[model samples]
Target: MMQTLPTLKKVTTTALVLLGLLTASCKTTPATQSPAQGALVSAQDSHIAYQGRIGHAGPDAAELYWSGTTIRLNFEGTTVKAWLKDESGDNYYNVIVDGDSLHLLRPDTTRRAYTLTYNLPEGKHTLELFKRTEYDRGKTQFYGFELGSDTKLLPPPAPQKRRIEFYGNSITAGYAVEDNSGKDQPDSTYTNHYLSYAALTARHFSAASHVICKSGIGVMVSWFPYTMPEIFDRLNPALPESKWDFTKYKPDIVVINLLQNDSWLVKRPEHDEFKRVFGTTPPSQEFIVNAYRSFVQQIRAKYPDAQIICMLGNMDITREGSPWPGYVQQAVAGMHDTKIHTLVVPYKNTPGHPDRQEQQQLANSLIRFIESNISW
Candidate 1:
């Protein structure tokens, strides 16, 4: 029997949360240099900018679980500090300072303020903390930022005119993209969503983006208990009832890269998910095609005019002889919608999840596709 998930709640036993953080390895440590004296900015500060479907735990805390969730603030100061709480002590982040390349940061389970950046040149600077791990790693809370004396927070950065949202699996989440070992799976600390193709493509077009995806999820079934279709519109991934307000963030373009897991999972009749979804038999050609098409139609119903790109992988599912791309094609053809399109990133023959370099290559292919087709 499937276990019932609790309603997404704002509060939990602080002890268990703290214990989870305290249980991390001794190597996991927070930055020791906190601002001795300055203002403790509230997470509710108007000057701060946020992206992703974040849920709030309190008036001054933002709970973020999805990859690519970001909190940005501009301030003029010599030293900057931030207070972050890691739910499971497994999440990683990309600390992008002043739009620089990026510095990897792993916040310890501690609740104290961390000195994010300090001793910068005397001028205004931007600090963006980007979540690099998928939701399964656990939720993180953003308490606020702190700035030393003789500093003030600047106005929010200008919003991007272009907006894009991605729906995909491990590739889109940048899962294990940094690991090169031949292991079946690797640590979550190596995952970096900031370097994913979806993030790269959005940056190329200066589009604000939201990634609503989980690893192992497919349109029809997933390796886990839930599929993307059941969780796509949720504000809280674990809570089916915590629906996201689509009106708040409508994308000009939406990209759907699924079916990869289903392509392989459907063939495994003995797999638990397969047995639950299609007992004793594999999904037929028509069932598979219609399953994908129906999900796309669900998205269309939410965004009436957004261009939808039905994409396959840089994985085995997009191999030369793979029928996955054809399924997407047939689905789009059946939709009869001009805004809906299909494309496939050529298969990457690399082992495990595509490494960093391979992810860049996939991003380039997708960029080229969008350039050739979408005018934006």
Candidate 2:
């Protein structure tokens, strides 16, 4: 006989208080409740854990995810389904089961339900579904998960203690890093956020990663109207009004990789367009330096204790003598903040951007830098 769980509406505060007491009492035991007791779990149920830049839009929908945001659940069953809402045809995800890569699914509809996995051996299993695309693809809402009658939700894995927040442009978003097509252009099929240096570095350090990035955005200027300064605080990347409450999540380390787009855009012949839009003439080196400094200060204001690393490219901002690297150094120095540091990686010389292989190298270099410098 299978237990029927309480519906979302029927779950009273008193019942929840009792359940919390029960959960606290059994710390050493598995967190799953007996499914035979007729306990139904809703999407908003406390047992279901979420990670990385996630925002709740409504009672049933989880929103504001960039690449690498994940939803996890532990349940004892042979099948599970996720009700996902992604209007864009380009949204994709990687499904992992019991620490194994299972399938890649493209939720190509406005609102559709997907069977994440099925027909597994009956026992406790874990599922991790990762969003594999960046914010530009579109936003996805996780309504909830559906488990089999015999199955019930278990406690999710313990959260990672070390957390890192990466802020940058397309390179940080892993834009076209996997393309290897030499076109120097972004293609949806070639973009894989999981392979980016930010993700790879997070995996190396066993840290929870939050990627706050967009393609072709910089501190002073962007390919589009908005720059990192204008949009970094938003809950939804697509909506300017959706402000993110920064206090909800804090990072031990904050890595800012701006300047690549700015470097290329500011120096180009059509730089007047930037001046027109930004209400300034061609940005001088001094203007860029001050802008970068201010942006770093903004991050400091948000994360007072975080170790800030200002980095510039495995792309155009190559070598020690470059003006771009100087700008980053000058920005950190001007702050007079000892907690902030700077790093510059060697150029990869890839056609479009650092491909997977190059990103791996960059990740390795960053890992070494962190290992040598930061105590963590």
Who wins the TM-score comparison?
1
Residue 5, model 1, lDDT: 17
Worst lDDT 10-window in candidate 2: 17-26
> What lDDT would each prediction earn against the true structure?
0.80, 0.74
Task: Give per-model TM-scores.
Answer: 0.89, 0.86
Please give the lDDT score for candidate 2: 0.74
Error (Å) of candidate 1 at residue 36 is 15
Question: What lDDT score goes with residue 314 in model 1?
Answer: 90
Per model, state how many residue pairs clash: 0, 8
Model 1 Cα shift for residue 197 (angstroms): 0.5
State the lDDT at 68 in candidate 1: 96
lDDT of 2 by residue, 272-298 (tens): 547655554577778888999999999
lDDT (Cα, tens digit) per residue for candidate 1, span 221-280:
999998998999999797778889999999999999988899989989989999999999
Give the poorly placed runs of model 1, Cα more than 4 Å off: 1-37
